[model samples]
Target: MPDDEPALAAQRQHWERTFAARAGMFGSDASAPARAAALAFREAGLRTVLELGGGQGRDSVFLAASGFEVHALDYAQAGVAAIQRAAEAAGVARRLTAAQHDVREPLPAADGAFDACYAHMLFCMALTTRELLALSREVLRVLRPGGLCVYTVRNTSDPDFGRGVHRGEALYENQGFIVHFFDRAKVERLAAGYELLGVEEFEEGALPRRLFRVTLRMPLR
Candidate 1:
């Protein structure tokens, strides 16, 4: 955390190992947020989606099946492979592509390459505020004007908040996984140049992680 490259490397390694050891660790269910995002993206008349942090590809398969061309990225190689396999299994491989990427770096897409962007829980990873800001800008750059972006993040109100090893900058470590928790102010901060269309509170998992489902739109200018 704290924008330290060494720490980020460690975090990436941890995730890589975890994903390698636990294929489909998150199971094959498309998250509730992803399901809702599909409808919202469809309603917005979106055709292409760039999905970040597509762990195991459940959302990738589902979105492709829902008729959206999806390009999914994951930091872990295993996760990216999982997505490809899931896409093939679901017979949506033609509509879905998977790649390994780290969001802290520049996105591997041209400006205005995608009609929409989606992320299930990528913003809450072991990322610093500065890194999150840069990532938001990258997401902005990759989207077409008026394109929508739907993402979810674990919020400060979550039950596990402040319960683990403090990693500075509102980040805490639990079970060897670091998470950068967001508050409403932080969410608004990242919405900088975009229109913050919606922020809805929701819960997920057995711990019932409290999160905010956020939607943003780029200006048509």
Candidate 2:
């Protein structure tokens, strides 16, 4: 809701079109990190999980198959619909719920509704540092005390910075969206309330993609 920054809106619109046109590329695949996250959730006794920016629910389907009650949220209408279709095809419709939710607004769920949360490639979509922090806080708010937050973001230290559009070092504000690069230290500082359990950086695929995978735990107290 709030009037989205125009540039941000444009970028989102671009993504919406891309997702709508290519829904097939968004579904479940066998990825090591995804499988690892699901296994971690199961071992930690997290039966209920909410996946923010769940895209087409590839991860959601995996989590549900792993026996977790999964709620997959995305802002794109087509993305949600694709997830729903995928769930039905997989025969896990009863265990998976796909809905349209703007993470910038209050999460459309009860407080402490889930045992854990997972966001793969969700935070990177945010264009601003403020938006990222706000989204992070909102994620914290919905999670139960001691619940885990596992997510990934592009690292500032990645050798490929500015390779996309050659944007300058200054904060790039497009429409209403803001995207700033972050290193491990910055992420740790922003995620203050949660204990930073681990950080892993790796390059994937032939595109030489850089990813920082992190696991954080909300304090039980």
Candidate 3:
């Protein structure tokens, strides 16, 4: 909601309309990045997850079915509603909670509340570098010590990296949507207060965008 940025309300409407236009945006199966997060979480013996940008609840439902308690947040009310409906349909409503939440705002959960946080492409959303840093701090705040933050970002090497109008910083306004691309240095910088565990590259979508699955961990005090 910065003066130079798109209004938050407008952003919410954009996503709402995008979802309304189709029966589904993302399909029923969770994205590969999310599946990978599930594996990592299970290996780490983590149970509770806080998901940011939980569009349409595909991943949230999948994670809940995988036996994790999930709190899924999306900016658009439509998206949150979709999540709620999907959770009910999947009979994971007891394990899943959906809410409309803007990641730019402080997380609603209490400190040290979550064992892991997942975001498929939340970091690459149309947010300023400062906002990303603040969001990172918020993630650290809500996660217990040694908790993990697993997220994906369209990296500089992505096929659509330079396809749209450049927006001053690493951001590009592509087809009315904004994406802030990331590089390794940028990822590390945003993860300043956390321990950088790894960055794995993968291709997704018909465009096969080159994305980085960056994993960070909050240090134990």
Candidate 4:
């Protein structure tokens, strides 16, 4: 992709077509980690939230239904539109707002605009660590002081599973997108400002089919 080009539009189109073709795969329930993170915030007294890179607004819809006022951002137009439609259909449209925004740029919202923010499977797909750190800083910029930011990234130390596997040191590219790999230590260093609340790893299938999963939280100071 060129420097001025926005890859998100293509990405959004790809997912939109996929979801439309297989709506059954786009389950109404939130992902395991997203649900766990949201429940954690609820237990900690957070009702207002922001979701960055909230593709198709699955988690945003769920959070809004659970009584959270959600501002969901995605660079893909289709993804944002899908979220809007879904929110309307779910009758929580008033609780949710979806917009097209890039994480690489400064967020339009004011400082301390949200009590919490959540992202799922977003960071790992970046082409570089700098991109990931830039996105992380943007998340920190929009969050309230001492608020929480929760998200997941692939673990690097896991055996080379067939999923997202690359031939060499070059980052993995799928459908013209790049995904950077990281282990726990690198992620901790990248998210230095936030306290590392937790880290977990898991495998999906046997070696060549396994995926390493890590979840962590950072507190905005």
Candidate 5:
């Protein structure tokens, strides 16, 4: 099968290069958003989770350690390797699976294969608005009924919004990375198939990025 379309292939190559330059792209800690989702996962009795753009497997390892089966997907092979090593070291290898995947394509898992889905800044990773909408549908497709999808994205209120060169729509090419900042309207529009649970605003990093933690649940049939 084809790896990815031209645009997505370019993005994948960029992330691969980034990961190769450093031992690990993101740090070893699970993202705050992922940690926050654990409580909701517990409340819902979720067992299996599909994590998109799981850079270096930090959140996957954490989720697995927390007793949930995690399938962590990233575009970079190096990141997948890191996740595999981390899971083994954490003694959660049986509970964690890592693979290289591009979310721009349809998710490879069976329908309703996962009890929950998580993404940390995956929606903001240079994907176009249309691609994000398609991905939301794919996420919903792979999730079991009533499964929750939790994701974070830089919001339009972020301090860095519009600070970089425009890359079309709400996207910007900043420094060496590309970002597609979301607004409340865009979030709602993209998440139409699912029930919106809540949206929380939080800040992170030195840029003090304004981000939204969006929670959506597939309606029970």
Candidate 6:
């Protein structure tokens, strides 16, 4: 593990405990962003989706049932198992795959293996700026040319942006979880190798956490 990003390995353990404690922590419904992404994916003729941080499989089951081939990855073992359970219960097991993976490493898929990549608030996790950049490059690597990457992150406008214990590099810890806040410049910096398609701000949860939904695309040569 990299010394600078020490919080990540601990975070995996935190998530493991959290997921084990609460079976359906995020509830059964798919997030609004996932619903929106599904429509866009369908319209774009993208059939395969790689979902990162697929907590509890809310979006994984939804996407699979909606006809997109879904492969959901989460660092926590319990979370990954919950995804598989949810997929099986939804009868979408045939269409969905769940795996435990740390996104800090290279993505598990082959080059050009997916048609689209989606992650709802995954970018806002305990990852640092450098880790985010590397993860973005990995996303680009696994996507087919012209494939789309849709991800959301809490922005600087979020209510908890600077609250709680400060981790290095735009990250803050609340309770036991850490979040990395983003701004327009950071988004643009990560968009280096991809076409920046859109950046839309939205709100979620009772705290009304402010977030940005970023869409990027690999260019066709």
On lDDT, the candidate that comes out on top is: 6
Those runs of model 5 whose alpha carbons end farther than 4 Å from true positions after fitting are 1-9
lDDT of 6 by residue, 1-221 (tens): 22336665589899999999999989999999999899888888999999999998999999999999999999999999999999989999999999999999999999999999999999999998888899999999999998999999999999999998888778888998999999999999999899999999999999999999999999997
The sequence of per-residue lDDT tens digits that candidate 1 reaches over residues 1-221 is: 34444565688789889888998898888889989999999998999999999998889999999999999999988899889999989999999999999999999999999999999889999888888999999999999999999999999999989987888788888898888899999999999999999999999989989999999999899
Cα lDDT of all candidates, in order?
Answer: 0.92, 0.74, 0.90, 0.68, 0.88, 0.93
Q: Write the per-residue lDDT of candidate 4 for residues 1-221, one digit (tens) a residue.
A: 23222443355466556655654344667866677777878987887788877777778898899888999988767778888988999999999999988777788788778888877766665435566677777777777877777776656654432235352332454555545556666677767777667676654333432233343444544
Of 4 and 5, which scores higher on lDDT? 5
lDDT of 3 by residue, 116-207 (tens): 99999989987889889999999999999999999999999987787877764787767777788999999999889999999999989888
Candidate 4 lDDT at 204 equals 38
Off by over 4 Å in 2: 1-4, 166-180
Better of 3 and 5 by lDDT: 3
Tell me, what's the RMSD of every candidate? Answer: 1.3, 3.7, 1.9, 4.0, 3.4, 1.8
How big is the positional error of residue 176 in model 2, measured in Å on the Cα after superposition?
Answer: 15
Q: What ranges in model 1 sit over 4 Å off?
A: 1-5
Question: What's model 4's lDDT at 97?
Answer: 95
TM-score between candidate 3 and the true structure: 0.95
lDDT of 2 by residue, 1-221 (tens): 23245555565566577778886774468355667778778778788888887777788888888888999998888888988998999889999998987777788877778888888777776445566677777777888888888887767765555444323332344433344456776688668778888888877656555878888887887
**For candidate 6, which ten residues in a row score worst on lDDT?**
1-10
Backbone clashes for every candidate come to 0, 13, 0, 1, 0, 0
lDDT of 1 at 61: 92
Taking the tens digit of each residue's C-alpha lDDT, what string does model 5 give over 31-144? 789889998999999999999988888899999999999999998898898889999999999999988888878998999999999998999988887889899999999999
Q: After aligning candidate 1 to the native by TM-score, how far in Å is the CA of 87 from where it should be?
A: 0.8
Better of 3 and 4 by lDDT: 3
